[model samples]
Target: MSALLQLSKLIDALSERIGRWASWLVLAAVLISAINAVVRKAFNVSSNAYLEIQWYLFAAMFLLAAGYTMLRQEHVKIDVILHRFTKRTQIKIEIFGIVAFLFPLVLVVIDLSWPLVVKAWLTGEMSSNAGGLIRWPVYAMLPIGFALLGLQGISELIKRVAFLKGLIDDPTEKKLAKTAEEELAEAIRAAAEGAKK
Candidate 1:
């Protein structure tokens, strides 16, 4: 159990770093989009590469941050009703969800996508659109993202189980502080959480 917890901490650290890194991609995507638009309109020049790269960044941002999101417990959930349950019950439900849904889903996605990524890389596949970037980098994101997600899922499962065993604090409890960006995300989440009420 201690060993597993240590592994969980390591995974959590990695997820934290990756999440922070992924945050920069959001700015990068925005900047690229703005620049691409200006270049296309002002310079009367356009390339499929520019357009595809924007979506590629968006994809990378989403894919790479999944484990980080999971580590932060920032992923969506039925918080309103969940808050009503006892902590142990909630942890049990979380364990069940991780075991039954998260792990299998991650495995399936990686299994299906790995072949495509390998094929794309090996074949040196390029985008059909003129001047578009190679496809493998984007294709590779699927397995890499899901693998990270699976690792975080393992860490979360360990933490939840340990919590249930009275070995740790509640894994679902809110953190004490939030970054400015996280506060804004929370505001948006709070509004979207109208569904929860």
Candidate 2:
């Protein structure tokens, strides 16, 4: 169990690093887009490559950060009814969901996409658009992303089981601070209330 916990920590670190790296793609995409727009409007010199690269970066960001999102417990959850249950029950349901749904879904996506990635790489597939980029790298993201997600899933399963076994604290508890949007919303509500008073 301790060995498995150590392995989970390693996986968690991998997901964290990859996710942080992937997050920079957002800034890169935005910069590219702004530059592309300026070049098109000012110089009337733009290529489909710029547009395609932005698209590719955005796709990569979403795909690569999936595991990171899962690790952070930020993925969408249908907790309206589930929240009524005890913590243990909630954790048990989560384990069941991860096993029954998450794992199988990841496996299927990787299985279906791996051949396509291989074919694209072998054929040297490029975008049909003039001045666009190669296709295989983006195609490869499916398996890579899902593999990362699967790894994170394994880590999460280990952590959750350890928690249940009284080996550690509750892994389901999110340790993050309030998001920027949440803070902003609170500020707005507070200002409104002050104004009313």
Candidate 3:
């Protein structure tokens, strides 16, 4: 139990760092797209690299951010019916879902994607578009994304088990509301800081 908690913490910390980097990737992608549009419209010249860059950035952003999302418990759950259940029942369902569904799926994806990415790299796969930039890094995103997601799924399973064993209280009831409020406050603070700047 203690070992699982420690491993979960370490993974959470790593996910946080990855999530931050992913956020930067998203920001860079937006800026690049904007610049690309302007260049094409104003200067009547566009680089072939920008299209590939967008896909790479978007892929990295989604893949790297997945673990963070899982850690934050922000992933979608079809819980319209589950919400009416008792806490113990909810925990049981969660445990079942994690063990039976999530873990196996993640493991399969990570296992399959690893070889797929390696093959892409070995073959030097590129965009099918003629004279377009070939981005090998984007090919790497598949295994990396699923790998991080698998780590996160492990952490989540541990957490769910802990909750079921009565080691920790379940926070599902108010977790979303609290998270949303916190996010709103953060946005407000950022807006104020930008205004001051």
Candidate 4:
């Protein structure tokens, strides 16, 4: 159990690091899009490669951040009814969902996509669009992203089981940290109160 917990921590750390790095891709994509637009509009020059690279960056960010999202417990869930359940029941349901649904789904995606990734790489597949980027890098993200998601799912399962066995605290509890927007709003409120005083 201790070893399993350590494995869980490692997976969590990996997901966290990947997610943080992938987030930079969002800014990169935005900058690329802006530059593309500017070059197109101002210079009347455009390249399919630039446009395609933007899409690739977007896909990379979305796919790569999935495991991180799961690690952070930010994935979508219907908590309206779920919140009514006891903590143990909730954990049981999550375990069932991860084992029965999430794992299978990710496995199927990786299985289906692996061949495509390999084919793209072997063939050196290029985009059909003129001056477009190679296709394999984008194709590879499918399997890599899902594998990360699957690993995180396993880590989450281990944590949930550990919690049930009294080996750890509740794994589902949200960390009590303020978002940037929240912190800004709080600062504004404090400034306003100070002015009134």
Candidate 5:
């Protein structure tokens, strides 16, 4: 159990780091987009490569951060029904969903995508667009993203099992500090109460 928990922690840490780093790609994409626009408008110069690179960066950010999103429990959920359930029940449901849905879905995607990635790499596939980038790097993101998501799913399963066994706190509990929106709402409520007082 301890070993499993340690492995979970390691996977969580890796997902966190990858997410943080991948997030920067958003900024990079935006900057490149701005530069591309400026160059096209101001200098009457443009390159499909620049536009394609921006697209690549956006794809990379979304794909690479998927596992990180899951690790942080930020993925979309139907909370209306889920929140009504007991914590243990909720964890059990999650385990079932992970095993029954998530794992199979990711495995199918990875199985389907690996050959495309390999073919692209072997063929050195480049974009059909003139001055555009290679195809394999983007093709590779599919398998990489799904694999990371799968690993994170396993980590989440371990944590839930540990919680049920009295080895850890509620894994679904939000442990991070409040978001800026939450903090702002709290401040507004406090101010309103103070005015009434």
Candidate 6:
């Protein structure tokens, strides 16, 4: 029980950190794109460098945001049917789907991506695009993302196991799904802060 709580806390901290960093990356990408557009249109100066940077930034944002998205239970689910099931049934389904399907997929992604990243590193792979920015560093995000995802999946699986054992109550699905009110409130708060700044 204590171990599960400790792991949950760690995962939460990691998710928050990743989410913040991903947000910053996205903001940077937006700023860079805006600058590129202005420079090209106003100054008649374009940059292949800026275009390449956009793709790399987008790739990093996608990969780095994945684990945090999963942690928040924001991933799409076909829960139209699953929502009607009993708690015990839900647990069984999670054990089968997650243990048999989800975790294995994460492991396979991590396993395959590691070698791909290593080869990219060894060969010093670069974009074929002329005047492109650094590419090998972008390739490295694949393994790093999957590795973090795999770790978080393991942590979630352990928590599920503990729930099965009655060590902890399953986290309520209702609370997991944020209501529209919550979303609106968050948006309003953000807008207010932005206005102040």
Which regions of candidate 3 fall more than 4 Å away from where they truly are? 171-197
Pitting candidate 3 against candidate 5, the one with the higher lDDT is 5
lDDT of 3 by residue, 8-51 (tens): 78887888788766766766888899999999999998877888
Range of the 10 consecutive residues with the lowest summed lDDT in candidate 2? 179-188
Query: Global CA lDDT of candidate 6, please?
Result: 0.74
Backbone clash tally (model 1): 0
lDDT of 2 by residue, 83-131 (tens): 9998888889999999999999999999999999999999999999999
Better of 1 and 6 by TM-score: 1
Model 6 TM-score relative to the real fold: 0.82
* Model 4 residue pairs with clashes: none
Candidate 1 lDDT, tens digit per residue, 29-104? 8888899899999999999998899989999989999998887777999878887988798899899999999999
- Candidate 4 vs. true structure, TM-score: 0.89
lDDT of 1 at 140: 93
Flag clash pairs in model 3.
none
After superposition, the stretches of candidate 4 with alpha carbons farther than 4 Å from their true spots are 178-197
Candidate 2: deviation at residue 60, Å?
Answer: 0.8
lDDT of 5 by residue, 113-196 (tens): 999999999999999998989999998898999999999999999999999998999988766866534654575688789999
Give candidate 5 regions above 4 Å deviation: 178-197
For residue 194, give model 1's deviation from the true position in Å.
42
Clashing pairs in 2: none
Query: Over all chains combined, what TM-score does candidate 1 have?
Result: 0.88
Candidate 1: deviation at residue 124, Å? Answer: 1.4
